[model samples]
Target: MIGMYDDVVLSFSESKAEEAGMARSMTAFGRCSDIVGGKSITVELKSVNNRFLDCNSRVPRAYGAVEERIKPYLQSRGVVRGKVDVFVSVIRIDGGETELALDGEYLRRYIELLRQMRDEYGLRDDISVMTVAANRDIFTETESGATEQDTEDIMSVISRAVDTFIAMRIAEGENICRDLCKKLEHLGALVGEIEREEPRMNEAYRARLEAKLRAVLEGRGAGAPDEARIITECAIFADKVAVDEETVRLRSHLDAFGAALSSDDAVGRRLDFLVQEIGREINTIGSKVSDVHMTDTVVEMKSELERIREQVQNLE
Candidate 1:
């Protein structure tokens, strides 16, 4: 959802599960405006998910130095990763003066060139001050002096904007955390189902194998196959198809993911690693299982893990 408050726009996502306060999302926006030191300073910050911190800024040309400070200040405030854009607008409320000086020599040369063009092309002789003034290079504009106080006011507004930005990130992160937790619960349930189905699937496979062996022996008019040989084959089949190790590792990865979501520190990278590990286990199980029901269950688990991975990419 998106909302507007004065000049600031805020967007938040909704989730059905309970909110968790930990973690921070990389997508958010914040804006702040204030009148200070005879100037109206407004700072706006926008960020989106990125693998690394990329900060860019646009400020008044006279205050170009402020641009250099913005990125470092954001880093100091714990903004680790995102594509961040900073926009600043400063309007002087005080009666600040600007000096304009005419370039007499350039003006003379420009008029002379205009006359030459008119004579050469036989164009209308309609040169006037308004027309000549269109060449703004004939005038030099000297802006009022900038001071340290201006930089201070701009940084102050930016500080407030950063505070609001982080707050929004945290709020959105809470929704993400809640959604992730719900998905993790679903995945856990799927894993449990796979575990319960494993024994039955092995039993079914054993029964089919035994029936096939008995049919072959009867067709050849031979005595019944050795019982010990049948038992040994079934044991080998069960061992080959077992998913105990994969499921156990998968559960462990899920627990680590849940714990990372509860941490206050930056866990985006950690969460990504856990998701990859979980995917490896799921794929291993998928490869080992041949039962239709087990295959469908594994597919569902992969889908849920993918959802979690998408959310983790938006974290910082």
Candidate 2:
């Protein structure tokens, strides 16, 4: 679902999601370029992740007070999350909506109050042109403002561009998923390799322990004393630090991760959770084992998972 439009030279940026945990952070820029011709308006949307849709608008300074008018356009989009920004620039097109002058209720109230002021005290009898001009809101230029229909026309094309931007994000998310799945497959294979090595690894440790115990006894002149007791204690220590159970559990976690990737639910947040668990398991293995080569292999597995996780952050 990559965007059909060409990539415009829009400024782009990103934030590390881990720094803002549980928050799906994303930023994108899209301009309609030739969006629509409605009262000569050009609209662009800039979006960033937020817990709620907090849209702000910026228009030509002449239309400062009318910025709120743009909200009615974006409000109907049903965006529940994001700090959305809208930029509208008017190009001074002719045939714009002519504003209507008003003889509003406020004008009548003003005149009534002025009459009361004069009659009550017989003071300040002034009905000058300045008195009328002081109530500026009571009058406005005829046909001199933008129309709702005009804003709507411009928004239609801007919507197209924003939707296109969303599609691009989804397309990138798909690619990220593919690459991460491959990395997970490699990590799964490494877990299998480590599992295969564990038994032989345990045997090597047993032999080393047996030899070292004999050396220690001989140094203290007990080389041939209580062999059974020494072997039993060494076996207990080895079993306590055994990583076979941990490796098996790690494989189960990997399987769960694969299923998550293929699931219909949004997996960005889920993948992040799985990755943190994977890291914890790998760390436990590295800390429990004293073997340099085994620890090195575990580090490699973790490194690959970490790289995959960096991509997962971009998913939604």
Candidate 3:
């Protein structure tokens, strides 16, 4: 039930349809707050597109230790490429009052070491309890450091916030995918128009060559022009301007672009490379084809390509 060219056309159409889903673009914001061990901790995540992952965080001094852990955790959670910023704030239910614990062992060891230093240097024995207590290292405050339970609770909230952020980014990426696919479809149609006009170019060149040959022969009083020679010259002109290779490569690039869009991996760099190839092929077509209609079509295709490039810039 299919014609000769139907299979090729259907294959092309199927490839286009396969490009409906992808997950490269990223731009989202999410915030979550929860109560843990009588403290309220809030986690905020904001992400935008970047070629590589660049994660930074702002957290309360007590939670500063988690800042180093957050980057690796986010990278594990599929944040492979972006400019992501995290903000964490903690509010204590006990009015921010810190409970300090004294380390008797460390205090005794430290004072003993100080006395040994003074004796060895033959210095004055003016060491007092007040002087020994001045060092903050002797006391450990509950609010200044995170316990194991606090770290666990913070991670829970962060995981939830990251889920929400990724969800938002995927939703926006789907919309962008649809827009880019539409533009690609339009570009393909333009290429088809050029293809249809391709055969006519040969015909036009042949006719012009024949006319010029006839005019020259008539002026020289020759009986007739060499028909075979005119045909050979026309063939050479057609070869000189042929765009078949460029069009075929352009179509291949389009298919690759679509496939990359629907892939699960980070494809921003791949898509950018494909875009350059597409643009190069289009430029080649523009240079070879001198027909006014084909030239106009090439111009429109370039405009559409530029729009797609702008959108691609936002991808991860």
What is the number of backbone collisions in each predicted candidate, taken in the order shown? Answer: 0, 5, 0
The list of candidate 1 runs beyond 4 A from truth reads 1-21, 98-143, 214-224
Q: Which candidate, 1 or 3, has the higher lDDT?
A: 1
Each candidate's lDDT (Cα)? 0.83, 0.65, 0.78
* lDDT score for residue 9 of model 3: 20
**Candidate with better TM-score, 1 vs 2:** 1
TM-score for all models, in order of appearance: 0.78, 0.63, 0.75
Q: What is the lDDT of residue 272 in candidate 2?
A: 78
Per TM-score, the best of the predicted structures is: 1
> Which residue pairs in candidate 2 have backbone atoms (N, alpha carbon, C) closer than 3 angstroms, thus clashing?
98-143, 98-144, 99-142, 99-143, 99-144
Give the runs in model 3 whose Cα sits over 4 Å from its true position.
Answer: 1-21, 95-142, 213-224
> What lDDT does candidate 3 reach at residue 5?
19
Give a tens-digit lDDT track for model 2, residues 1-316. Answer: 1121123222332211111111122455656656355455566777765444687877654455456655554444333345778887666456565555666787888888889989998977888768877878677554356566655665565566555544444445445556666788788877877777777777788888888888888899854769788889789877866888788788877877767755544566677788888888888887777677787789899899889777766555
| Candidate 1 structure quality by residue, lDDT tens digits, 11-123 | 43322111233688999998899998888889999999998899989897667778889989888767888999999998887977666788899999999999999999999
